[model samples]
Target: MRALTHLRSLLGSILEKKGAAWPDKATIEPPKDKQFGDMACNVAMLTAGKLGMKPRDLAEVLKSELLAADPALSKVEVAGPGFLNVTFAPAFWQKTVEEVLEVKHCFGKFNLGRGRKVQVEFVSANPTGPLHIGHGRGAAVGDCVARILRAMDYEVSTEYYINDAGRQMRLLGESIWVRCLELLKKPVTYPEDWYKGEYIIDLARELLTLKGSALCDLPPAEGQDICYEYGMKSILDGIKKDLADFRVEHQVWFSEKSLVAAGAVERTLEDLKSRGLAYEDDGAAWMDTTRYGDDKNRVLRKSTGELTYFASDIAYHADKYARGFNTVVDIWGADHHGYVPRMKAAVQALGRDADDLKVILVQLVNLLRGGEQIAMSTRAGQFETLADVCAEVGVDAARFMFLSRKSDSHLDFDLDLVKQQSMDNPVYYVQYAHARICSLFAKAAERGVAMPECSPALLARLDTPEDLDLMRLMEQYPDTLANAAQTLSPHVVSFYLRELAGLLHRYYSANPVLAASDEDLMRARMLMLAAVAEVVRSGLELLGVSAPEKM
Candidate 1:
């Protein structure tokens, strides 16, 4: 980081001295091949034309300026067209060990967000049935994104938009009512679209104990309404518990019904109408979404005087902005990808920038066991619930597996592999690396080999390729986390942890730490291992996965 900062400063100073306009940003990245250098910069190639100098000639000048500004740079070579590959003195890498040790678990945090107020809404599954494995993926992705943003110093508010006012809730109520009638041994007809989950029968039995058979005495509509309200609340309660168990706690549970009751939906429609963005056509209100890139105008209200689902969503988004959030992120199922443009258009019509509303479409999860796909259906209540999967593989494994890929890609969660205690299981591998480090330290203590204090002088003794590779990866943590937050994806965290763990395992097999006779080398290796362990723990924490000291 210091090297890049110094390079940027030197480039700007040299540009100003040459009476040339300096670029606002410069790309200074660590080279992929270690032989290239500790860091590489392409500022010269990028700005050569602007300065009217040949790329290599410009790079030579910047390289000289950078070396003069930072004596820690051992060498700077111009490679290819104009890339400046830089090598840092050994002391620079050594200093990073002490720095990471001093910071401990907070090593990967970056201030890139600058405290931007953002809200992340994910896994807002309706209060209709138990959350399945698909919802599990969204929960993990959304929660990790929120965690990464917070790590980047964003003021993030996590939310779950409770879709409590939709047709699903009505169906849930009717389902429960019919189940109740069945329990009462009364003749009843069931709708084909009604929920068929066994939980409805369970709910009916519970309702029997509370309301008894007296509910049957009321008019059918009244009884169903009573069931709808009670069923919605009960299912929502279950949903809350399931999320809490999965370590996903939302700061807000915004209810859709509340918007209708508070007249927010009507007010939003009125505001759009006042802006000439909404019009009535044949007794139905329409939004001019096509004006903002939608495929066609969308219906806001039907001729029957019923607001469309899109209408409620627009009002909800308006509420999100009114709550003072500068950015609002919605994590929806992958099936909703087509819904993105329409929602963005609605935000524009509401007088807010479309970019302020970001949507992440999470793909489905296919559960596999014994090399065969398991069938699932939420309506029939025969799907693998998130809670059940967690119970089988444990929370750490479940969270890690769900976040192991891009959210938009389908994940075939192999139950057998993740539950293994071998290298085949990534969660186990990473946690084992941490546990191995802890065990090594414990054994060292038993042998009266105390960990010496960290210092540049001792750490400089580490010169092997393995040692340098570990330090390089650890240093990339802040950048990797920033990328994850900027992209709104948590898969980066999982990938980083796995790579770091692989390096640690390789180092453990090749090096002799406590057994080494040289005191300085042993201390340096121990300090390095400790830093690696802390980094692994920190990365795991970001993914909401456990880093156990013991397997």
Candidate 2:
């Protein structure tokens, strides 16, 4: 990273001398092929036209200036039309080990956000039932996004929006009430449309235990209300426990009912009307979402005067912006893909840029065992709870696999694959690399050999191609984290870790660290592995997975 920073500065100074503005688009990165060089820059192609020079000519000048300005740059060549391929001296890369050791766990952190406030609201499933595997993916993606943002120095607050005040809550209550009647051996008609999960029966038993037969003696409406409150609280408590067990936590649990109780929905409608965005039509209050690109106007209040869920969502997001979040991220199910445009329209109507509202739609997880898809039905009460999956596989495996791809891509969560302790399992492979390094340290200590302090002379001994390749990959951690933050994809980190692990595994097989002919070589390799272990731990922490000391 220091190499990159220094190169950028040098190029900036050179462009300043040439009286051409430094292009923000200019980038220095690792070339795709290692044979090309350690790093490549596109400054010439980015600035050649502005300076009235050919790209190749500009590239040559850059190459000459780079070699003249930095003694660490061993080779600089103009490759192709306008690219500068750079190779650093062996000593320059050797110092990277020292840098990683010096920074330790904070090696990949960057101040990209600079304390900007960000709100990530995710896994806000209705309290009608336990979270299924689909909700698990959202939890992992949103939580890891928050973690990655924080690693980039963003002031992030996570939230779970509880859809408590809705028809679903009423149905949940009636479902429990019917179940309570059945438990008491009373005759009752169970509606086909009601929630039929076994958890509803469990809730009924809990309510009966708490209030006794007297609860059923109350009027149906009154008894349903009681069941509603009890069911909501019990289910919400279970959701909280399940999320916590999965290593996902939210700073806030915002209730939709609270928004309505505080008159925020009415206030939001008033603001929209004041902006000429809302009007009364057909005995209902409608928001002119069409003006903001929605295909049709959205109703805020129905003819019967019931506020729609969209109205409450607008109010919630209004509250979010009023709370001073520079950016608001919503993690929703992929089924809500059609809803994104309308949500963006609402945010724009609320006076925020559409870009400020980031929505990530997570696809459903296809839970599998032995390559066979498992059937899941939330309404039928025959689905795998997130807690069940975590208990069976593990929090680490579940979290990692949930983040193994883009949020919008379907994920096949094969139960048996994750439970395997082989290289085919990504989480296991990455974690094993860390454990292997730890074992090396333990072995060295048992053999009475201490890791040497990093120095140019000591690290120079690690000049093998494999040694340098490992160090080069280790040095890219900050870049990988930055890319992840920019793309809002924690899977980048997952992919990077897998590559690092694979390289480390291959390097370990080819090069013996503890059995080296010279004691100092052993010490240098130990220090390098220590830095590698630190990077692995940091990456896994960002993914909310543990770096175990042993497999």
Using TM-score as the measure, the top candidate is 2
Predicted candidate 2 versus true structure: per-residue lDDT over 1-551, tens digit per residue: 77788788888998899999888888898888999999899889989999999999999998888889989889998888889998988778778789889989889898999999999999999999999999999999999999999999999999999999988899999999999999999989886689998899999999999999999999999999999999999999999999999999899999999999999999999999998999999899999998889999898999999999899999999999999999999999999998898999999999999999999899989999999999998988889999999999999999999999889999999999999999999989999999999998888889888777778788889888899899888888998999999889899999999999999999899889999888888888888899899999999999999999987
CA lDDT of every candidate: 0.89, 0.93
TM-score of each candidate?
Answer: 0.97, 0.97
CA shift of 26, model 1, Å:
4.2
Q: Residue 221 of model 1: what lDDT?
A: 85
Task: Give lDDT: candidate 1, residue 78.
Answer: 98
- Runs of candidate 2 with Cα error greater than 4 angstroms are none
Q: What residue pairs are clashing in model 2?
A: none
User: Which runs of model 1 end up more than 4 angstroms from their true locations?
Assistant: 24-26
